[model samples]
Structures are given as structure tokens and as C-alpha cells.
Target: MEKKDGSIDRKYIPILVLLFMGAFIDGLDTTIVNVALPTMAMDFDVSMSNSTWIILGYVLGLAALLIPAGKACKNGRVKKFFIAGTLTLLIGSVVCGFSKEYAFMVVFRTVQGIGAAMMSAAMPSIIVRLLPPDKKGIGMAAMGGASGVALILGPTLGGFVVGVASWNWIFFINIPFGIVLVLLAMHCLPKDGVPDPSKDPTPLGAVSVFLTVGLLLVILQNYGDKDQGVELMIACSAGALVSLIVLIYSIKHDRERAIISTKMVLNRDYILLGSAFFLSTMMLTGTQYVMPYWLQISYGMSTMESGMFLTISSVAMLTIVFWVGKLVDRRGGRSSSIAAQLCRLVLCIVMIVITPPDGLLILAAAMVFLGFSQAFSGTGHTTRMIHHATPGYEDESTNFLLVINYAAAAMGAVVYSMIIAITLPETTLLEIADYTVRMTNDAVNFTAVAGIAFLVLALVLSILVPNRVPDKSGKASEASDAPDNASE
Candidate 1:
């Protein structure tokens, strides 16, 4: 069953497929509803502000449940929860498609979010648990690549689906894939690993919910034209601030028993990995969120034309993740990440000189490079994070890494929004469609600066990444680590 490289046998392929299925759905679910919001709001007879909850509710659910669901993975219940989560999402998606009321839609979406949290939290731990060091990056790559592709394709695909079919069809699309994935996961994932769960939920869970959800709400308010009012936003922001203080206090008081441990809090490598993920995501989302508007507004391109440009960019990213994952496996995290970061840095620097019409072809070329860097660096960071996953807290480590990604993306949206607001005349996202070329050009200029700063920060962090995981024993443990993955 062993390969000459001291990796697991080919049997892991089916397991990898199952894992990717979940990951892809999780990524797609995040953005698939975005393009359909306007139609959905009208169909449900709700204002755009109220309809926004459909997105907010799902995101809050995801943030609230991530840590708790991750904690559940600690006990040998990862497989149990994984299967349960897939089923929950499957059912929830179908129900969401059938919803007759906005409340029902929100509730179903929340259910899907809970399920996604479990799958996302459990996946990295399971991947690390299964693959040997030599092949581990490839495994993580499968996940990262599937997710990256989904993120790229979701909005475009959602719009196409909505144009041809009802918005409900978007939710329905998951049913067949979810059903097959659930079955494969149930049958193929290694027998459940040893569960080492604590009985108490502790104050940490509630605090995390408050901090993550509250901050997300505040971010959402600023990230868009949602005028939820100054007072309400202030209240949400205050709640989030208090929650952070409570989290710090808990970590300080109960380092060992706390969900957020001092070891994790203070670890240098973990901090670097988190920074790399956060900053890289900020660059990605900031650019991606702006590019479509920049194209449509600045060049007077149609929606479909701008979408095609993005698709080309995404296709490039989609192609690179696969091979970069293998490169990560061979080169190790530090080298791969550093190289990837450098590539991204070059792309951002080049993007500064790009303008509409005269620079369209050049921009497309830059996008190709952008996609490549996102994939390579993304896979590298993922590989390192998984390889360095804390022994006793594999789930927690992965959970925190993913949370950093989420937070960074939200931050990117808010940051880009602030830049645009400061640079351009006031315009809602809905109204931004009609923005003048001058307004769009201003947004692009500001976005480019922000992207450059983020990439620079990420590059510095990547330099600090340990080239490879330190094998303290300094001997081949490949054979030894093999069986542990099967039963640990």
C-alpha cells in the first residue's frame, strides 16, 4: 500500500475526491447567491437592505459555528460530523430552494452554513491526518484548488444559472453533487480517528460567536451602502470590541483549557502562516471585488464582457493550483511560498501601470499571472499550515487558519470600500453600475495601492516561513507516520 516515496497508496484518491467535493461546495456557497440577490429580493417582496440578511445570516452562521464545530472534530468524531455536515447541507440546500418566505430562506441558508463550518473545520485536520509529509501538500492542494476554482466560478456561474433558470435552481445544483459526495465520504474516509473531546463548551465559544459575528456585521455595514444607521453600527462595533477583550482575558487566564491558547496565540510560525493567508486573501479579494466594476465602468463594457475577463483570470488560477500543490510537496512550504509571493508582488507592481483600452490586453496578461500566484502561494501556505498543524489541536489550528482567511476577506471588502468611498463620489453598489470612467479609474488606482501593500506584507511574512517542517528526531519517520494517519 506504500508508494516508493513513502506516501500512502492510491486508495486516497477517492477520499480526496470526497474532500474536494465538500470544499468546492463550501466555496461556491459563499458567493453563488451574490449575483441573484436583486432578483431574490424582488421575488420575496423585500427591500434590498432586508434581503441582504440572506447573505449576512449565512455568513454569521458560518463564523459562529466554525470554532465549535472544529472543537467537535477533536474527539474521534470527525468522520461522524463530516458525514452529518454533508447531509445537513444537502438537505438544507434543497429546502432553501423550495422556500416560500424570506425567513425560511435565511433559516435554510443558516443550516447550510452550519454544515459548511463542520466540513471546512474538519477537512484540513483530516487531510493532515491522512497523508504523509511528502504527499501532504498534494492533498491540501486538492482542497485548496477545488475551493479556489469554486470561488472564481461561483458568481459567473450563478449569474448564468439565474439568467436561464430561477434562483432556486442555484440551490438545487448542489443536490446531486452533495448526494454523491456524502456517500463517498461515508464509505471511503478512513475509520474515524481517536476522539479526544472535552465535555465543557466553556465561555470561549460564546465569546468567539460574539466577536466574529459582531465584527462581521460591522464590516458588512462599512463594506457596502447598507445604511443600518450610525447608532446601530456603533452598537455592533462596541459589542465586537468588548468580545475581543473578553477573548484576550480568557486566553490569559486559562491558557491550557481555553479554546484560544497562549501557545497558538504566541507561536511565531503560526502567526506568519496566518499573516500570509490573511494578507494574500486581502490582495486577492480587494482586486477581484474591484476588477469587474473597474472594467464595466471604466471601459463601458457589458456585464458579460467583464465576466469573461474574470473568467479568463480564474481559468489561469484554476490551472495553476494543481501543479503548484505538487511543487509545494517537492519544494516544501517556505520555498514554495516565497517564490509564489514574489510572483504575486510582481503582478501587483505591474498592475499599477495598467489602464483601460490601451492596457486591456496587458491587464489580461497580468491577471493570468495574478491567478498563478494566488494558486501557488495559496497552496504553499495551505501546505505549511497543515504540515505545521499542532499535534493535540489539529482541528483548532486549522480552524484558526481558516478564520483568518474569513476575517481577511471581510477586511478586504471593507478596506476596498473605504478606498473607493474616499476616492470616488458616493455611490451604492447597485448604483455603481453607472459610475463614470473617472470614478472607476480612481477606484482602480486606490485598489492597486492597497493590493501592493498587502502583497509586500505577505512577501515579508513568506520570507520568515520555515523552509520545511523541522524534524526534531532527524530521521525518517515516514513509515511510522503512515499508520498513524489511518488510525490516529
Candidate 2:
């Protein structure tokens, strides 16, 4: 149960496979669900505004719960958490496949998010603990590569399913994947990294969850189809404000048990990289959120066609990230990250200038470059974050990535929803297909502005990061007394 001569302990390869599966499914779910939204809307008899909750709800559930569950990950329950999570996700997927009502789908998606949070909270820590320093970069990259594959194939795969089968297959497809992962977890996984059970979760943390959810709800409700939800928006805003006050009080008085670890937040590496990640999420994943709708609604593209086009970008992303991860290992994350940001900054400019009227090839070129930019930046940042993880705080470090990533996602959904709702506030999307081209351009223009703002901020913060992994005297979080890494 330790690192061998120049590779991972062979006994633990099964565990690594399970961990990779976990990463793939979690990442797959994030991107795949977006492609099916239009079909789901028709099947469930809901408006475009309501259909979007399928996306927002999953991000919300994951964002709100990851904080508490993150700390709880140190509670010696890794296997149980992972098993329960996969099972819950399996059940939720099956249920989602059979969702007869919009309410049922939203609820199941939320359930899936919760399960994903559990799996995500545990996987990185395990990966970190198991690998030697030399491979951590590759391990992170490999895990990321799995997600990148999911990102690359998600829309296309989901679209294919929607085209060939029903959208229900999107969820149902996870069934066999989940079954194998669960069996492997039951058999070969080791109970290493036993967490301190005494570190009980505090109620103060729960309040922050409520506050986070309320804020997201307000954002969604305000931008919702004009037919309904204004009253609910006001109520959520009030509730969020009240919770914010209570959360501040709790932070001041019981700082030790606050929802987020103030110490972890203050960690210099965490701050720099976390800020960069937030901005990237808004720009990268935000585009993932809106582009499908934009394609279908504006260009009258079929779900399958949109998915194929989007796959171009994701393919670019996967290739760059895989290669750049090696570059991060050889050089460092900061340099790789800054370069990626510059690439994206230029892409934003192109978006602002090119406009959809420039035609499909032009747009497709921009998408490919955007994916390349993400691969470089996202891969480096993740390696840097994992490189900086302090023992006893690994879970927090991992959770920091998930929180900002999903929080930005939830925020992006709200912002994009607002953009679409404001520009084309019609209660019906049926006619949006024939809506004026100028309106679509206006929305894309505004989106470019938002992208520019977030990307600029990301570059500024990323520049301040150290050009190399910060020095940590401790060796790898090995499973047992192990030798220094020889793989390098």
C-alpha cells in the first residue's frame, strides 16, 4: 500500500481506476446535462426559464453542500461516502430518466449534485495521498483529462442520445458506469486516510449553505420568465440578506467552526489560484451554459448540430490540457496559467469583434482557440492547487476548487439567464427561433463584455502567483512509509 520503484503501487490501481471513474462521471454530468435541456423542456412541458433550473439546481446542490461535506471528508468515512454517493447518483439518474414532471427532474438533478459533491470531496485527497510528487501533476492531469474527455464528448454524446434515443438515455447511460465503479470500490479500495471523527460539523456552516442557495435562487427568480417567480425572488433575497447577517455574526464569534475555514481562505496560494478559478469558471463554463441555447434559439440549429460544433472546442481543450499538464510539471503552473489567460484574453477580443454574422467557420475557430486556452489554464491551476495542498487540509484545498468552480457556475447560470431574459423577455421561446438577429448579436455582445471583465480579473490575479510550486518540506502523503519519488 505504498509507492513502488517508479510507479503507483500496483495493488492500488483498482482504487485509481475508481477515482478516475468518479472524476469522469462528475465532470460528464456537468456538461452533458446542458445539451439535453431543450429536449427535456419539451418532454416536461416547461418553459425555457424553468428548464434551465436543471442546470442551476445541480450546481446549487453541489455548491451549497460541498463546504460542510468537505470538512466531513476528514471523518474516516471516505469509502462509505464514495459508495453512498455513487449509489445516490445511480438512483437519481434512474429517477431522472423517468421524470414525468419538471419538479421531479429538478429535484433529481439536485440529488445528483449532492452525490457528485461527496465523490469530488473525497477523490482529490485520495489521489494526493496515493501518488508520489513526480506523478501528482500527471495524476491531476489524468483526472482532469478524464473531465476534459467528458467535456469534449458530453454535448456530442448527449446530442447523439437525444437524436437517436430519448434524452432519458443521457441519465440512464450512467447506470453501467456507476455499477462497475461501485463494485470496484467495494473490492479493492483501501481505507487509508482515516479522518478525525471528533471534528463534528457545526450549525453555523448550515446557515452559510442556506445563504448561498438563497442568493442563487434570487438571481434565478429575478431573471425568470416574466409570467411567474417575482414574489419568490423577493422572498429569497430577504432570506439571503438575513442569513448573511447571521453568518457574519457566527464568523465573528465562533470563527473556529465557521462554514469556511478562515485559515484556509487566508492561505496565499489558495487565494491567488481560487480567485483565478472563479473568473475562469464564469468565462469557460459560463459559455458552456449559454451557447447551446444560443445555437438552438438563434440559428435554429438542431440539438445534434450544436453538439457537434461545440465538440470542436472541447477537443481543443483536451489536447492542450493533456500536453500543458506535462509543461506545468516541467516548468510550473504560474507560467502556464499566465500564458493561458493571455490566449483567452485574445479570444475574448475576437468574440467581441467577430460577431455571429461572421459565419460558422469563424465562430468554430474561436471555439477551438477557447478550448486550447482552457486546457492550458485549467490544467496548470489544478496542478498548482494540488501541489500546494497542506496535509490535514487537503480536503479543504480540493473543496476550494469545487466550491469556486460550481459557485461560479451557479452565478454564471443566473447571469446568462438574466441576459437572455432581459434581451428577449418574451414568455415564449417558440417564437425565439425566428426572433431578430440583432437581438442575438446584442446578447452575444453583452456576453463578450462579461467574459472580458472576468478574464481580465483572472489574468491580474494569476500574475501575482509564484512562478513555481511553493516549497513544502513534507514528502508526499504516502499510504505507508515510502521512499522519495523516483519516477522523475
What would the TM-scores of all predictions be?
A: 0.83, 0.88
Question: Which residue pairs in model 1 clash with each other?
Answer: 75-195, 75-196, 76-195
Poorest 10 consecutive residues by lDDT, candidate 1: 474-483
Model 2, poorest ten-residue lDDT window? 478-487
Best candidate per TM-score, number? 2
Give the Cα error of residue 306 in candidate 2, in Å: 1.4
Candidate 1 structure quality by residue, lDDT tens digits, 1-488: 23668565777878678767888888777666755665676688764334555665565566667666776665577788788888888788889989999889988888887787777777866765665545666667777777777766776776677777778888877777778877887788767766654532356745666465647555564644544567767777777777777776765665554666556556777788888878887777666656655666677655445555666656787887877776655555666676666766666766678676668887778778777776776687766775565555555787777777765655665667666655552544334334577767767787788888887888888776565542322111221112222211
Considering only N, C-alpha and C atoms within 3 Å, which residue pairs clash in candidate 2? Answer: 74-195, 76-195
Error of 2 at 453 (Å): 1.1
Could you give candidate 2's per-residue lDDT for residues 1-488 as a string of tens digits? 33445455676667557766887888788778888777787777765555668887677778887777766765666677778888888888889889878888888888998888777777766666655555556666667777777877788889899999888888887788888888888886667465664564577766577565747566564664676556777777777877777776765666655657666667876687888878877777667776786677666788898888788877888777757766665556776677667777666676668656446676788787887776776678776676555546666777777788788887776676676677667633543334465666666667768888988898888877665542233243222111132122
Collision count of model 2: 2
User: Quick one: best lDDT, which candidate?
Assistant: 2
Question: Where in model 1 is the C-alpha error above 4 Å?
Answer: 1-8, 31-59, 91-111, 151-156, 166-168, 191-200, 223-228, 252-257, 300-304, 346-351, 388-391, 429-433, 469-488
